[model samples]
Target chain A: MKSNKTNMKYDIIFFAVALIILVFLFLAYFFMTRSNGYICEIKKDNKIYGEYKMDKDHEIDIKENGKLVNAVVIKDHEVYMKEADCPDKLCEKMGKISRVGETIVCLPNKIVITIKGDKGSDSLDSMTK
Target chain B: MGVKSTKNIGITSLFLALALVLSYIETLLPVFIPIPGLKIGLPNLAIIIVLYLYDFKTASLINVMRIFIAGFMFGSAFSIVYSLSGAFLSMIIMTIMKKTKKFSIVTVSSAGGIFHNLGQIIMAAIVMENYYIFTYFPVLFVGGIITGIVIGIIARELLPRLRKIIGFEIKGSE
Candidate 1:
């Protein structure tokens, strides 16, 4: 019992320190990845559907055999699933996404919408425009 | 199998059912953030409880059965693969930590949660054929720790009382 108590104490210290480091890393990533420009990349069934400029306001309607299955809307540099035919509507409820590396996924429809930030050559215009 | 083993099987199946129901309820939660793959993993409570109350093999069986049943009931084929990998990895890690008897339940659970997320991320990278999926690691790690701590605390508080109530001699321990 006494040894277990000591083990608990040491374990608490270890987990506390680890949690602090994780929080630090999370905050650093959160702040560092907050670029203003992001590209909305859409994928359906693991295949690239389209890439859109966040700067442009447009709605993408994903159709299957001339039937609309999902709709993605990008306005004022934010992307969201505006509509989906899935029963749960989880993708629609994911809210707006503006950050790089953020994604909205509709599992039922197998649609994934992710935002990619400009990196390397800082080629924001070359790709989006 | 002996009578004792038969009893163990029944109890393990009960734990499996509990875990599956907990997982199902978790999906109904309206806590869908914009980030993908962030889940509170409520079923982890049942896994931890079984690990503490029973032996490693029983707990692992419950974990596997729970994942399979929950996947068939509430998840897609892709999700089944992701969850199977994550649950298996987390179970192995937690069982080892429990064997050490050097860490508290919360610490073990937190570690389990973190590894579970790591497993899912690896599977996601493989499935998507994109190494860039690793970019979600940090956020998922933080979320895993927070949720893991919560689960660990709950398990810690409940275990002693449950052991007393169940009135079964803990099958194995130091």
Candidate 2:
């Protein structure tokens, strides 16, 4: 019983320290990864489907064999999944992405939307134009 | 000696069966969280129990067999990859904590849970080739802690009762 008490004390200390470190890491990662993104690149089945400018508000319907599978919305310089036929609908609930390195993935549909800062002067000009 | 080995094998297989059933039950439950790979990790109960009752090698054998069997039964090839990574990582953390003997079973299990989620997240990042998937880390970390504590409590309660019935000494139980 005495040994158990000492074990409990150490366990609490260990848990508290681990909790603090993990919380710190979480906050640090969250803040460090936030940045302004310029383009939203959508990939289907690991292939680049299209890249859209974040400045424009538009809806993109991804189709497969004449059936709509997913609907992506870019509005107010942020992108989100508006609708999806996937079973889990996790992508739709993933909220918005407006920063570089942000991504929304639908594994069932094999669709990935990633936010990129800039490709290059030439590609950026062509995309904007 | 032969009889003892046979008894050990019997006990290990029983725990493996229990773990497999728990895995199947998990698949039947509806997705409560929107996170892709998040689960309550019910099968960890059997693995933890086996670890305390036997040794790390025995626990690892059961865990690997459970993941492969459960993965084939209810999941895809991709899921097998995720489970193997998560389970292996969690087991290693739990083993190290258990060896230290400074922490209780619940604390060890909680650590296992946190690392398990981390391992799966790492695998997700690799497969998707995007580091952004890690943004889900905070949520998974919290979830793992909660579920780990729950499973740990259950295992702690079950351990003493199991030892009484089986009439065997546990490795690291106080």
Candidate 3:
């Protein structure tokens, strides 16, 4: 009978609390880690493959387990997946990224390329408060 | 199995087919987020419906089957792994929430959505062997809330009408 009860008020209060908690968590994490210097961090097979300044354009070929899995290109303060051996090529299709939190992920190749800014905030950085 | 059980299977299959179509439609829509593993989760509607109608077991079956069928149809071999992890985790969380009877459909769905993303991120971390994947968590948490609310609202509106059409006794718990 309790399970069959449809108390609309209870639902509203419960979700409102849940939402507040999520928003709180998001804000806490966002403010704690916010940056905008454009640091490109690359990881392969769970290891730090390399870290490059976005301002310095270059290409990286990552080989894991004795196989060339992904090729990445960083140019013009932007990073993108240039080539991948995976079937979906979703990583390549992810397009160029310049923002602080954008990432290019190649699942099959076990590659994750993320853009993180250095220790300075841009004037337009909204999350900083 | 008896005739009644067979009938349940037949109806469940129909739900599976509908879930497959919804997932295919989702793939066709151009994803706004360039990030991989973010989806509007339209197929969640079917799972929610099955959950409210029958029980967790039926919902779980439909959830796993839909991932397999829809993955092959609209995604790659790799996507199948991601979705299976996501859908299974979402179903378990949602079922637990629903049984508690403390949360509304929307809240349950929102939680389900968030856990769905959590499941995928966990899988990605394992498959990619990278813990840095947690950095994407904040954005995905917000996305899950938004999409979960939408799916929950849709399921709430559809469930009553669907029950009438099927003419099944509204029994709570298995």
Candidate 4:
């Protein structure tokens, strides 16, 4: 009897919870679908370092061996890491970014940037704008 | 009642008490919450133990009650709105997976841990007072998986003795 009454109170509690989870899932789905951008992939030594959103215009100058090489954001959808002095020149071959998941890495200087879809609150432009 | 049933209930209660203790202990852990309701799930150790030693039904019942009471007494009880939801989702996932072939104690416990975190995130998002949490989810998802695996192994080791205490024998004889 005691457990049942306690259970009833809990049922009401969980029901409220169910409603909340549903609301959040709806928001996540909405926010995710609303954002359709690209990611800038940066790799070091063929290893993925991290990814950043490509929704804004930012300048990154790749300096290898203390010399300015490549720095460009191709488009809202494409990015290029060209004009590096590295002998391998693998990142230059990554070409243009056409999709959400693309990479531009400079291994010699130990810097990489990958374009990913919808990340945390670092970039306020998406929500504010 | 029969000795078997009595023993089962006893074991379950013991786990329930253990979970309560772990829950209280976790509450004391340091939190740097620029956002709300975010913390590492530690009571999950008991929940995982329950899922492994007892059946899903028992674990579910205990988990629901544990979270409910603990939330009120130790946490923001009035915020049943968040606690119940997060705890329920976590318990449900853990219970369902408890019986699956791919669902070892480790996997189920880890799922519980991850879901617990996800559930809370969902609630926080709804209280929708903040969007900062939405940004760090990728980090949370990967973190959830890692923590789940670690907690899973701990639950797996504790399962055997727990089963015996509950008067249930492990398969494959003594």
Highest TM-score against the true fold, candidate: 2
Off by over 4 Å in 4: A1-129, B1-5, B32-35, B129-132, B168-174
Q: Taking the candidates in order, what DockQ does each have?
A: 0.37, 0.36, 0.34, 0.02
Question: What's model 3's interface RMSD, roughly to a tenth of an angstrom?
Answer: 5.0
Each model's lDDT comes to: 0.79, 0.83, 0.79, 0.59
| Descending-TM-score candidate ranking | 2, 1, 3, 4
Q: After superposition, how far is residue A119 of candidate 2 from its true place, in Å?
A: 6.5
Give the TM-score (vs. native) of candidate 3: 0.77
Error of 1 at B7 (Å): 1.2
Per-residue C-alpha lDDT of model 3 across residues B68-160, encoded as one tens digit per residue: 888787776768888889888988999998998777888899888998999998888778765556667777888888899999999999998
Estimate, for each residue in A14-73, the C-alpha lDDT of model 3 and write its tens digit. 677767877887776565445554788898767888999888989998876778788899
Expressed as tens digits, the lDDT of each residue in A14-90 for candidate 1 is: 68787787878677567645666557889887899999999889999999889999999999989988899976777
Flag the better candidate by DockQ, 1 or 2.
Answer: 1
Residue B101 of model 1 has an lDDT of 78
How displaced is residue B53 in candidate 4, in Å?
A: 2.4
Chain A accuracy of model 2 expressed as TM-score: 0.77
Q: What TM-score applies to chain A of candidate 3?
A: 0.65
Question: Could you estimate the TM-score for every candidate?
Answer: 0.82, 0.83, 0.77, 0.51
